[model samples]
Target: MSKVSLKGLLSSRGPSALRSLRGGAASALSDGERLAMLDELEKSGLGWFWASDAEGRLTYISSAIAERLDVPLADLLGQPMTTIFTAAEREGRAKSLSLMLGAHKAFTGMAVRATRRPDGAVLRLAGQPVFGTGGRFAGFRGTGADISEEFHREEETARLARYDSLTGLSNRHRMAHQIDSTLTAFRAAKRNCAVMMLDLDRFKHVNDTLGHAAGDELLKQVAERLTRAIDRECEIGRLGGDEFQVMIPDVDDRGVLGELAAKIIAMLRQPYSLDDGRCVIGASVGIAIAPHDGVTCEEIVRAADLALYAAKNGGRGQYRFFSGELENETIFRRRLEQHLGEALREEQLFLRYEPIVDAAAQTVQAVEAHVCWNHSERGIIDEEEFAQIVEGSSLIGDVGMWAIREACRRAVLWPDSVRIAVNVPVPLFLSENFVGEIEGALTEAGLTPGRLELEISEAVFFGETSIVDRTLANLFKLGVRMTLDEFGSGYSSLAYLRRAPFDSIKIDQKLVAEAERHDSRELGLVRAIVALAGALQMDTIANGIESAPLLAVLSDCGVRYLQGPIFSEPVDQDVLEQEIADGSWKIDPGAERTRRARRRTVFRKIEIFHDDYAYEVTLRNLSRTGALIQGLANVPKGTQFVVDLGGGQLAVATVTRSSGDTQGLEFEQSLVDDGSGGLCTRNRVSPYALASAGTPLAALAPGSYQGMVGGLIDQGGAPKFGYAPGGRGD
Candidate 1:
């Protein structure tokens, strides 16, 4: 043990022993010397040796590992080698240890994690198959070196590449690859995959008001909410900066996709309390289905992106499914936006007024000024279309100020009692000189400030609290009545009502439209809003009152003023002035009768089937559960027929009334909502079902086939009744 003794021992050691220790070449050393060298190597604890039998059972293991693993040598011997070492380990490349041992192949530098060792050592293993002199299958002998630290470092590097550092979700690159791979695999399997593109609404506002740090924190919370909202085996990724994408596999049902999209929108809209302040934002989702919307990654993603753009343009905070019509809409919107800048300069923009009638007095109370754009080519674009074009544009303020001035000027020509109401967008109303602009318009037009009403939306609540409050207070002090527009259309806050001092609330047309339906809850909501308005000393204006029944309901509900198609469509300034000069415009109390179902007039060809024979008839009107058909002569009452609506929609109906060539038929089943302002059959003819029935279908192409056994009839032979080009038969 002394230094002199150790020096003498090393001096006596042969060159062969040193060479064997260095593993240069095999030395002709005695068995005792070889055993001593192996013991010295095991004692060094830098490396370990392992061997397995032909059965993949551990036969030998270094004592150092055995001691480190805290397992007795007898306990480890004859155990499955896979039990001691984890499965496929990843170094530069990954190879399954069990597979390599089973194949008896040579492998090296496989980073394997030790399962038995409590220290969780990652060992770099090198193994070569050993065979007997007879060339029989033998076992594996491998050397392992601990590389846990190195493995973790490499894993961290890989993690950075695949995940978002801020949110810890998949990054853009990873999401794209994931969608591509999933869609590719699902395409071959004839499965469906859906991709949803989400954009956070008002995220930039938060980032601007608070800071990037708060925005980042908000995104983390959004990611968490998304993960919880989906609750499916889908890939959710942050596609950088408030845009996220979700790849859902094996889901093609629009209903399910819509529900998920709604859930995500709702979850993200909840208020987030950051370190600085509380903020709320919404999400818009665009969904595209594989093989239907597109097949390729770019195609599908582009489709979804277009849908997202449409959703955002459609007034934000909603989900839209990709359809062929959306592309045209997007293009039209872009062109309209371009044209909108020139609208005011070219004198194409003008204001029209729809009369607001006092329900009790049955007299004109006010007229809302709606901006109308008469495109040279398109001719009379809807207000909504113009809104979509001007939304979020600087030109909106110009146009808005022009409208205010023009409406004030127009109001000067009207009778003293009739007031003029002009809608003020949140941006325009919150502008620095909004109050000054109102005053300027009034002073220039020589109109009373009280007659000029500024209609503001609840979105003003989302702006700077103090600024919005001050702006509204200043407007109120300017002798202008400030009415809250589109009440209940979004997050209507009680705090906003209590703080800003609004004079009236316009019940959103959506609520009014829904109240006309059979939904009692919507009616109750309308009643509550009216009662709430009354309690706050604010008047309620029922909007979109197209039906006489809705008018009666609102009148009975004590709604003070009304504005809709029922009273009048927006008229030019001349008509509005003439109506005002001709005394008062009173709405007829008994304007129309109430009906159970809403009917839309139509003039299109519809195929009718009776006793295996198809007849071509003109559809004069349509409802959810019935339709009136002309050109079908002598169709007796109670005769059953199948009406072929377009897009594989079929409705079985029985004739309830017949007079000559005109007949009314009642549907066997009610139609479901098409999500747009239309009705469709709940079920459609599936391509797979058609293929299963021996029909050759590449996909569900448009058009109908007459005289085909399984296809819906498009046309029929000469009809029993005389053919009429118009709905009425001679």
Candidate 2:
């Protein structure tokens, strides 16, 4: 190695610097002797010395250091220093090592990496600018010490801090930091982002039944699947336990987000093959878009959380988009949960059995027990309330057992030919007293065990399966009829059917709806399920057959038990007793030939745009495909308008039916759920779109559009149609 140049600095600083450069003993040595000592130091491996010419290309480097880098000293001599060493990001003393060199200034302890080393060696460099005889800049001379060991230790520590040990995905701290920084950076750019929050449904059941190790494996599999399912760029993190968060950058369309959310849910719902056994769990997704939901990480995460809770309460296995009403809905659900126990105590909880008629005989062969609540404040609480309050509450076990006993008590009074199928929640089915509760219900009612069917979902398989198998065996010995509910929905297993003693299998309602929708492989799955059930000597039950065409199709596929609106809605015991008093009940299916979408009654005011004019109308009822509005007069069939359903939700609709001042509208684009039992357009009119019209980029406020207002009011245009005169109806 060349001698570290000290003569230029010594001449600049005079005798004091010379004395400082050479210690008392070394001062007696000549310049040649001092250079010899420096050469010996460079030969040692403790550290290496390097000198670059004015062009920043390496002129002289220790041959020992070149050996470590696995390059010949001659090859490194002419190469740029940047090619050999690059600044380490962890120690950003300068933006870059090249910058300090460009400034011709001194730098010390700047961490760097060896570019060609297979061992990934790290080095801490200290350097100062060198000058020649004329005081003109020459180049740089630097000393570098190996720091690879320390650097690796710190890097492993950081990896542990930022990643989950189980899933190897980002932990909570990393997720929070990434979300915060991304939102802060995107704020000025006005770019939108979406966050999806998910938690495994019945995940606790898995932990309780299988071991925690199995649960860990399931989480790893879930993380892998999540990584594969996302086609776009995203950051997925596990926020502890079964909860996960996905931050998708630069996407705000509810249509796109909703589809992605649904896709994630579907992927997560698939059965996981683990060491324990086949475990099937579900996921619920709650999404929130940035700037609209919140501008900060905490706000968006909280919003997504609220939406997730709503999805769980609404019944698991669904995705819900966040809205302003989520907080209120959450509070309402909590209140209902608190009152559910009282409702049970006061006998407000009751069962309504929807008859499952035999497809071939057209006779009521069995009825499924559906629980309903009679809340004093809400009059008659619907099934939605029951799902959000009763089933989701801590008292699920108590409510579930009560329903079993009550259904038995009621079924005992029914005709012997008809059976009663009661849904068994996973927690209650796994409870220690589960078998005893069923035995007690049967004994107290003095009902035949075979007449009371226990409809168990596949989630029951996710728990300590030995106990589950024992429970099933005991129930079988007790002669309690068992039906596998929603078998083909997610947990599609021939092993469960072969091992468990199921008297029948329940077809998922989705397949039935799909059969009504189209002639696709979904129907093939149904036929296969029916065929398999037949070979197993088990009957098949198809639920949610709402239309005549669906009923005919299911009948052709050999489904024995049929239930849905095509027959009748769930009725109270009194009505059932009256219908089957003569010990025989047969009913005709409805005359409806095709399936129709269910409409939600919503009497709210909305705006409709026609030919640049806005008309105020009262929205009577809304569905995914259509809505009814009554306000403007003389709007004939085939007329088109843009309907605004608030929150920037706009749908282009054409009038399909017309009456005096009342018209039925068919939406070109379907609506999506707002997580609050309301319908909204799939895609909203973005504020960025408004910016093109000279409006500022911001969140859409709750009101009519400013552009629409100017055109409707300032133009002095005549009214398009005469408004209905106000009377008591207004």
Number of the top TM-score candidate = 2
Instruction: Report the Cα lDDT for residue 298, model 2.
Output: 93
* Candidate 1 lDDT tens digits, 163-242: 89888999999999999998788767767788999999999999998999999999999999999999888998988989
TM-score against native, each model: 0.73, 0.83
Q: In candidate 2, what are the lDDT values of residues 339-452, reduced to their tens digit?
A: 988998999988887998998889998888888898898677765557656657889988888889998998898889998889988899999989998999999999999999
Query: What TM-score does candidate 1 get on C-alpha atoms?
Result: 0.73
lDDT of each: 0.76, 0.79
Alpha-carbon shift of residue 408 in model 2 (angstroms): 4.0
Best by lDDT: 2
